[model samples]
Target: MTISIDATHLADVTDFLQGCEKVVGSPNVLTNAADKSAFLTDQRQRFTGAAIAVVKPGNTAEVAAIVKLCNQFKVPLVPQGGNTGLVLGSVPDSRGNAIVLSLARLNQVRAIDPINHTITVEAGCILQNVQEAAFAADRLLPLSLAAEGSCTIGGNLATNAGGTAVLRYGNTRELCLGLEVVTAQGDIMHGLRGLRKDNTGYDLRDLFIGAEGTLGIITAAVMKIFPLPKAQLTALVALQTPDQALQLLTLAQGRCGAALTGFELMSDLCLQLVAKHMPQLTFPFSAHYPYYVLMEISDSESEAHASNLLEAVLAMALEEDICQDAVLATSSAQSKTLWQLRESISSAQAKEGKNIKHDVSIPISRIAEFISVTDGLLQQQFPGCRNVTFGHLGDGNLHYNVSPAIGASVEAFLDQQTAINLVVHDSVHAFGGSISAEHGIGSLKREELLRYKSAVEMQLMRTIKQALDPLNLMNPGKVI
Candidate 1:
């Protein structure tokens, strides 16, 4: 929590701001208290930082020039994209000596090639706009997330974000084919290639994709796109247990195969929270079950075909008693309503009370056991703790969260964060699962990473950080 601002560095902050102003007009370079506040806090408000100035560079060249001047003045610069990250990775540090480099002005769709199934876009472009552009081109950029409207492509790539569709299209790493990055020392690496087969010396694109802006600043990228699905089927099913839900998932994948795009699972507790917070949205089922799943399948076929396919899967699931009740969307309006129920889980949890969130992943086969065992242990250890389990079941990732009991205060429940994390993360490690499934190791999980990662892995990360940014000025004190 200690933030140190060297006195000598303070003397040079003004000159650094002036240099940035020359590259991108003084108006774009903000030093006022009000203008800098937006870039100081993260989306989750977990950490509030202080920056000397916030600079908005319009293009890659401007970003290069600003980075070059920061290197010369020995001033650390934090590359910010939309500021929609759950972890505090996109925000400036509390040192009050760094500059928050905003990429919002760099929003632009550079190119879209439907033939090659690739879309090259600037880093600052909103994710929703990128998706819409692909749709306009008769293509699909399947990186759908809740924050698509506000989050930028650069932040998504930086964290290697995984949304509900990761089961089908993979994370940002697999979506990106090329990148244009600016080195820590200010040299621009123009590597935006849409080619699918490139056996180059080194895959530098990957080095910056999930590096969280510690290695370099990403300006633009060439991402893989796909043909838009002609039809999609959506369903909401009620299950008695996680075991039954896993059985249903396996059965659906066997029947639907590649057409199965999304398979999400949630607890009745999650549904109750959603119902309590969002009364306008109606649940598809008449009665609530212990567990629920909102699944979707898409294909290049007619709506009737999609509906028939979903019907067959549901019929088989019912025959096997894997699901207690089920409801398939008959119209696009109903499909959206089913999705609303699934998407409202997070927001409703927020409305309920303070909750501790754990985004972890285990093998698909062990997921049910992990959930049941973890729930039992948590309830036994911390009496009256409410467990909210849900996530992309097809990919084996779960957002296992905990909220305080009805009478308990949020502060008292949060006091057990350390104990809760240890127990939950320990179980995940024992199952050979990851502590951080989607979110990166920002300051929040840096210590956890050190405790779990091997010495060789940590050393290799440090070696790469040292090579890319020898001065350690590029997002200093993050990741490595």
Candidate 2:
């Protein structure tokens, strides 16, 4: 491996770019501050920074040269793909010394081997286009999300993103069979085979998937593809409590089998927020239960069976007092209407107030306990804190959010962020859960991750980071 960056050679980055322009064309590189400004800030606008330049490598060979040049100059390189990452992994540093290597120009659908039921795509390919390609081949990518239209495959793989379909098809990492990465020194790690099983010597592909570019830049990937579901069933079940939501999940899972694709939980507070903030959407069910779960089960079999399964589950759950009331979507449009209630939480919350949220995870069995305990704890600690809880209950991840007190000043409430974080994270730790669930640690949870991670574990992370990015050039001041 090439030695990392040194402050002494920092001035030579411009010279390196000058040399690159001679070889790889001037149009590919970006040094202007305005263009780089948008590249630096995150979607949340939480963290912003500067980069020496944004290098748009048009192809694999060009990317390799940019990496080699950066390596020789010892310039920190931040590999970026759509720049849609919630985490600051794709953003550059405040120092404005490290180069941002943009992979967007490498967009290509190299192969779609429908025979093998696999698609080989470059990292920069937009996720929507990937889905379209798969659809054209009469298959579904099955990794659907709100950002699917804008996010890139590389970003998804890097974050190991868990979207709506994660309960069924799995996250980005699980869908992956192989990968192609650009090492710190710009060498390609190409092992793009659609192999179902391979007992390779250490799984190097898995390392780069969720490393947040601390290890290597994911250039391309070979991901698993699944057959499109023939029929889909969506339901809105009003539950009395969180435990009932769990029971509904169990009942749905029992009947639907592998087709139980999603079981998303929503607090009545969430629906209220959605209705209050988003005036366009009307509630499918009346304001009744304290909790609700929007579930979708898809099968290649029969819609009748799937509907029957849901009805049976709802009937049993209601009879046993597991759920208060249930309503199945009579049409696709109605189903979408029900889904919109769950999907609009973030925007609704944003409009409501400054959200003090914790995206944490605990054991499935401990979910009921966690919900009950956390609600009480929040009420005790911060008397005015409103507990707006919801998320993928089946996967044991919940967005345990504590909104700013209704009557209190926002700044004052946000002032206790650190203390509030400790309260939530400590509870998560008590349950053997990660400080972060779906979202990457990014700038938000870096300190929390350090606090929760054991000394030995933190040391290992530091070592790996040091080995890959010695100068700390890639997405500096974030993650590890």
Candidate 3:
């Protein structure tokens, strides 16, 4: 059902507010501008929207009741968690005809079964908190990202978030065992089972996992966990080019196999920016290289064993000319500092100037080609545009970002965003890659998705959307 924006019923905010208050007490319904301001904007501050009220519900029952009231009053709903999304999927629209349904108050660890390797957590629990809970139970929830400190599990599942560990533990979809969701019509579906081998019909759990709240609101979930690694080995290696990095990855994988947990790639330009902006950070090597790889290996054995394995792999890589230089972290603090160099790329880029970012994934074999081709094309068309590339190379996902030259006007560079995106995304599509790897198709890429997705695929998605959210009251005008 395609629901168009209409302001005719917005005048009934008073009654809607009263209904919401009845569902989740009056104090939880924030209507003032000051109270709703934080929920109205996205993490990047790229988009600011309006909402009739920002409602916080404390439990699944309250979430159901609040959703039920929204449906009854014909009010649109935007289910938000942490508001940490890169895409504008979590915020309300500018029309102020919707309600921002916040699940922060619903956060709680419902259950933990170490033997079963599953942890049941409420939707609003922070990602880092979930990781810590798993650690407390002698398990590991490996869906890690830089924003884990602020991003919520529900948001992670909603976006099907892919982080550095995707090369190993897989995305949020794979990490999840079951989900307790409130349907578009406000009916709670208690499907939070930790069974690993359920041949259930239609796979309803998956439908809502990456739906971005267009079909339903995720209230809680049971996620899969793994045994905690006894030791971790981190290394920062310099390479002449991406091809060399790729070779190093293949070698490391063959040498370490399942112990290899992370393989990140960054351009020398990225490291230079980090050095210039973040003077306190220490680089692994004194001289700069064109590319670098931050690789990590984890095992259920002694630290010495893991380190020996890593040293052996690095020795092979060096002898084979796959890497120019390597630094094996000698201590936990040194390992953290090496990882911080890779994690600080985004912040360093922000300090440079206006930038165009693309979260794309291509075939592992064609990653180097994609970078080379796109970089050349960008330079040719938009002269002086700096390309700062880095990402989870092991998973074929790259943050292929471009920024204007140091002295260029940010506004002028932003004016050409559409053209820049066309060049970058067109190359990604030609390489048989997805335009959005971790981030879902929020309003940012809705039109691009239509152009790229096959007609049959789009039709199938619409069919599901119609079947589940006929009224289109749940996060209308986003995703599909």
Candidate 4:
């Protein structure tokens, strides 16, 4: 179905565009198809939506003015950052009635308080730039992820993203101290306090952090920073199974405590795909095991101390037969090379063919059992489907992905996405796990969210949504 606008509706849209142009110069208001193409598409290139125009506001005042204009014209607005979100939360719908509110021009580091250990930045600031700024100040913003190079802080907070350092520094939500948001009614909430504790009324910051812009637009944030680690070490340990990996995790945590920064688990097939597609990345192990774990430790002590701690943990694991073989990186270059193999799994899988990805989190104790049971069930229902499982085992999150059987049509395999999701998500629920862990419930998994959440939980979410956005003008058709 398509939306057919009459003369009156078309006139209203024209007036709205003119009003937006007045707020932020005509050059910032993109209405041509060529100008709006990049903003209309998603990161995966899976879906392309339609928007009346892409509006780029220069400052918070302009953003508030444009949002007020949207409300006046009865136009829906989709708040967009770097547009690197995997789900469709940052893109407009196909109705072509909404405007894409781009925050790209609002990029700025508002303040950096070294004494307070916090950095205040606009929503449009790229995550890598923030990290560099922190590094320049001899501090660390440890929200590390693959998309950090291009993903914006607003998108990160909107989705409550969890990345590689989540095992230690926590998700973007935990690292944030405050946020500056533009409400649905064009009101600005100036909550950018760098305080660690504030026993005020309701915690509005928590509500908007993971709302995916359904509640309001995040303009800026105050994020916590930490003293940089003096030394960091990485190691790759080959294990026989997920069970062994879990055992290794327990041992590492018991030995290294908070110094353990990363514990990533990868199946043998994951590296095989990497070797097949990304030939430049060399596999560290001489022989393949059923599974591998890439672990890291960051110490405030010297490099020798960090190395000794990591080596001691690996030595203990080897003595206990928890792992089959291990290779510890002796240099920073070697450490990066080892990390590259762990990070290349997703891209390598994409190069192979179309596949379904499930970012799930299960209890630490039941993860091994969940994998064992779920893999068997998937194979029983859809034989020959390859399971490329890997993720941050320390945090109980797994990127459990699936590939088509060799010689099978990729389209045919993808056609069974619904059935495949049912099999995997059902098992996850059976083990007390979440269907969507780090990624927000964008339109991609909205229906699945309903199936998993209870009626009471759903109703509470809807009540909150209704109270905050009564007209449903803020990013409709997402998260409820």
Candidate 5:
């Protein structure tokens, strides 16, 4: 007997879920609101949308089946992985009409080719775990970030994440060799060959890699690995301003060339926050400066040589007044400690107050000018404000964040976020910078992206959005 019922009622959705779960088994589908709340909310709680049910598909076929059913029922889908995204991309909307399709159970390492140096992994695999697997294989999966512990490979690929290794190993987009996706109509596009040279027509791999789930659902990926850098050196430099940091970056590259893998800038206000929040660090610099840079240099077998080269660069930078002082990590432990100070800025800022964060980028040559211009404009506009400047300066990206004046309530201060972001992002525009650097244009910057992106770019993105997701079932109300 064929049974039919209403689609909007909770019982109707639950009934539909029961039928969907029959294809996979009993443990993968959920309908209870309390149980699904965790999946509906984002990591930062900034975006919490409603979900009628949460579905966990364990494999490619299962994901396709779920998508087909959702399409037929007109239930919007939200594809989620580790829930680590910051811009409301993975979460549902306030409408509560969508359901999250969790990909965690799809976790698997299908194969590892140590010679060709690639690892095929399911989208649900945690990033750090993938790195560990590569490490065990005596190779390196160089894409890395602080959230590696929890963020999924799918999330990183979906956003085309750029982490600490971008200087040496480009972003996640460069590291990925191929992808396996579940189309909107439940067709499996199994583009899962580890081919090194395939000039095969349209590179579909690139489309799904950074589509943010607007085009299709990614189930797994083939990631490129590398022979590990045999030697590495990390150091922290003290600078008086953004200009000094910029000069120090130039000196390091000129001195070490390709060996320079990382160059991150920080601020005194950031350090103060670290010391105030995370006490493990003792502040290595002799004195505090307005700006700082923490960087790493790596080579095939030149660990000691790289250390010496960094010291030589530091000397020249100091003499040239590009840096005030410096501290080179002598041991791995000390290097990690130095990194802790740099990495703790985000957490410390969260504790301080509502920080208006701008993960922006400008021309590599115009970083210093962008900082100076934006700093002056911000200070003049929001007097008595604390502007904390820093980021991966080597890659033309900066986390130009600002905290409210001391003791200001977040309730009142947040109202001006729009006006403040306008001034800051406008300066970024004047410098020919991207409003959304590596963070991807999630709902947070959806409007801001429009302000910076040209009409032609927006039109192209919309065309792609319409082409791949004509029915708009794949993570609707996000990106384009």
Candidate 6:
């Protein structure tokens, strides 16, 4: 239900906003309906919430002051970054009592310590900007995704996002060494130390990294960077099934070792949709296969070395009948084209129609079996339903989305979202997998989290929430 404040509460809200304006100028405090619209809606446009005001803090100090005012006035606030999150973690709820504390103005690269292999950046620094900065210093900040152009580092930390390079560099959590957080009590925790090893006590940095702003607001961070690879190569391999893709994965890993940076799995239907909607992106293969794997290798040696390594692996796979065919990207343009196909699946699915999406992960060994069993089960229940399955198979994360059946009404198909989620999530659990892999348990999966997690786990999470945010004001109604 939408929150309607009484006369006294409205007066209190006015006072709170006034305090916010004092902390972060009147111009930065946005209360107009139009001004707050963009921040209220989620990335997928599935939900649009209401908020009292959208406040943009200029820096860490301003953020702390605004948060302090929130405490004094007993007003809940939602910390938002680029609002590119799939789950409803970044947006406020339907209740209009809360305010959106935007960290967009906090964008800044504080330092780039190439010697230490770290980069210190504000929470609002655009992910692509961070990558570019690291590149400028001849270092690599390898956290990459479709939304890197607009998504912020703060949100990345909040969600602990996993991207393409996760096979090598790991998630946002693994990459980050320290954080500068504004606690629930509006006190700044200055922990931005660029250290690879520090076992002083409780890891406070970790607690806030994946807390989704429920525990505290991440203002800035010290993230690990790596030396740029000498050569990077991309290849697309056509495989008959998920199991074969897994086999090829095992083969590639055995052959390339650390050089295998990315291994993505896409179904033929995924590319079919891409071809249908994104006609401009030419499909490389002459014929189609049931499944495909996009393998990437980053070599510290020469380009010829990288190419030779990838070719040898593909040759072995083909000889063993593990894959039907392979296309090695000979040029940079060709490599980009190959990667585009892997990245464009989601957008292609969107252009086709509305669908239910599940960001799930399975044990690497059981992934193929999980897919086979789950697909069969789904087919039995929802006949002819289109499964647009694809994701970072190397990391065992799958974007196992479902589209409407041929000639099926979109609304009718969407109405079955709850039932569909039950089947998929239950199967994931049965196979020792996670319901939410890369995406955090935002409001979308809060109930599902409760259903899946043990009582002890739930209680422990609640305890942490209670201990950290006693008032339950920081991003209320998220995570736990």
After superposition, the stretches of candidate 5 with alpha carbons farther than 4 Å from their true spots are 1-12
Candidate 2 deviant stretches above 4 angstroms: 1-11, 470-472
Candidate 6 on 1-480: residue-level lDDT in tens? 233542337667778878888889999999889998999999999999998899999999999998888888778899999999998998998868788999999999999999999999999999999999999999999899999999999999999999998888788999999999999999999999998899999999999988899999999999999999999999999999999999999999999999999999999999999999999998999999999999999999999999899999999999999999999999999999999998999999999999999999999999999999999989999998999999999999999999989899999898999999999999999999999888898899998998899999999999999999998989999988
Tell me each candidate's TM-score: 0.98, 0.95, 0.98, 0.98, 0.96, 0.98
lDDT of 4 by residue, 160-204 (tens): 999998889888999999999999999999999998999899999
Candidate 2 Cα lDDT to native: 0.81
* lDDT (Cα, 0-100) at 140 in candidate 6: 91
lDDT of 1: 0.89
Q: After superposition, how far is residue 199 of candidate 1 from its true place, in Å?
A: 1.3
CA deviation > 4 Å runs, candidate 3: 1-11
**What clash pairs does model 5 have?**
none
Q: List the residue pairs that clash in candidate 3.
A: none
Instruction: List the candidate numbers ranked by lDDT, top first.
Output: 6, 4, 3, 1, 5, 2
Give each model's whole-structure lDDT.
0.89, 0.81, 0.92, 0.92, 0.85, 0.93
Question: Which lDDT value does model 5 have at 26?
Answer: 66
Give residue 135's error in model 6 in angstroms.
0.3
